[model samples]
Target: MTEPADAKAVRAAETAVAAEAPDGAGASIRAEHLVQRFGSGRGAVLAVDDVSFELDREPARIVSLVGQSGSGKSTIARQVLGLQRPTSGAVTYGGKDVLRLNRKQRSEFRRNVQPVFQDPYAIFNPFYRVDRVFWTAVRKLTDLPNKRAADEAIRDSLRAVKLQPESVLGRYPHQLSGGQRQRIMLARIHLLRPQFVIADEPTSMLDAQTRRGFLDILQDFRVRYGITTLFITHDLSSVHYLGGDIMVINKGRIVEQGAVAEVMAAPSHDYTRLLLASVPAPDPDQRWTERIDIGQIR
Candidate 1:
């Protein structure tokens, strides 16, 4: 008897997951007293001011960092991903500092923590076919035996994100819609099954419908694969839709942090209230009537 292609892909993914699963107790990624200051002296700007948070490896969750532009939410994301070093504080994974990890540990850290960045087009090369991204990841990250296994895994990952392999595999970035490109990034996340997904304003470039779909996919990732997400966005509605922990950031600080419903319903911080008030009501009759003065809120 012969095995089916889909079944083979499934078995391969299962094997990969089992092989890569962390040994011993679960771990966490923690940011302690992080501060990112660009430049020097009086001219120095504090991008991330003493920000701290943790994402645990077990019991996957989605924690949203909500803030307007320049609030330092994206900087926090970068810090967590180990892309940018903080001025003072530390980003640690499994009790080891990310910045100080050795080559082997760093490779493990990179594999365990992946990012779905804001601009889909910017991540892809204009000249290369879309398949290159997956192939590169497979070659660099995975221990798959051959090209056949890699191709099957890539196809399976695409299907997991609800993208048809034939439609997406060979096309260039320009050939795909923004939604498709973004979904391909999600597909990559699915393929890797990283413990933490740093989604920095992933839906900003998407339309309302597409944005909703993208959020749904993030939620699906949490539920199905136990993947934790640091979902960074300026959109309060998206935060509400995501429905988990929410941290409201203002001027490089976390003004308030709590469950989404609790924070949305009764925000303690003035900045949080202002952010909530800024969200437009679905019904025209219940819309915000008064003009918001930004100068008054801080």
Candidate 2:
């Protein structure tokens, strides 16, 4: 497939930025001893417990944080995106603390590190046309000279995600299908061409086929645009499909970490094993025989 016009523009912009930046400028997002606590005294809940990981910028790849719901996976993402400050520890981007970045640095960080959140419906305004999202992004994040340039960029971005511009541009959030709305978010990412993507359960709301397509696009971004992703999810099937490094968190702790294939083949932690076993088998002839005690893992 031919690269989209907007993609070409992003490539040119990236090249320009690379030329001006100094050597060893490919910095990573690092979380050191991260801890997030909510409430107080005996009721205080430790959402994240000493979670430490590094998302490197070189050789772009997907690193999945897998766990059950309320397992601190999303909390870690919030910290990484500077949406919420950790109670203890730090989230640093390019060797500087994310919370402490200056205006310029913060702007650059926001541009370079973007998010694809879980709920597509919640991302847009029902009161306005869906095009507003793209227009707002163009106005704030891009230096497109005029309305014509912005329009072209938006059209090309929609095309890049396999959405026809005419069908999607003027519709409200309620007018589009779930998959189309999610792909619109992906198109936004394609337009921005961010170095890192914080995809928090981006495919959970899509159908099986749509979910696969979404994962394929993420892989393509890594291959074509070098957009590394921190894929946060509870689905072991999705984790196995998007094969990369895997970190298994259970009860606010990283119980196991390794390559997806390796960990899937021989999971060291019981929680990891439970997650893998939970994945439904494709063949009806294969019966699930393992009995799990929920209390034991906890």
All models, RMSD in angstroms: 8.3, 7.2
Per-residue lDDT of model 2, residues 219-295, tens digit only: 99999988889998876667777898999998889999989989988999887878777666544233222222122
Candidate 1 accuracy as lDDT: 0.79
What is candidate 1's TM-score against the reference? Answer: 0.87
Report the C-alpha displacement of residue 220, candidate 2, in angstroms.
Answer: 0.6
Candidate 1: where are CA atoms >4 Å away?
1-21, 282-298
Q: Cα miss at 215, model 1 (Å)?
A: 0.8
Compared with the true structure, all predictions reach lDDT values of: 0.79, 0.79
The digit string of per-residue lDDT tens for model 1 on 21-66 reads 4441366899999999999999989999999888885788899998
| TM per candidate | 0.87, 0.86
Deviating ranges (above 4 Å) for candidate 2:
1-25, 280-298
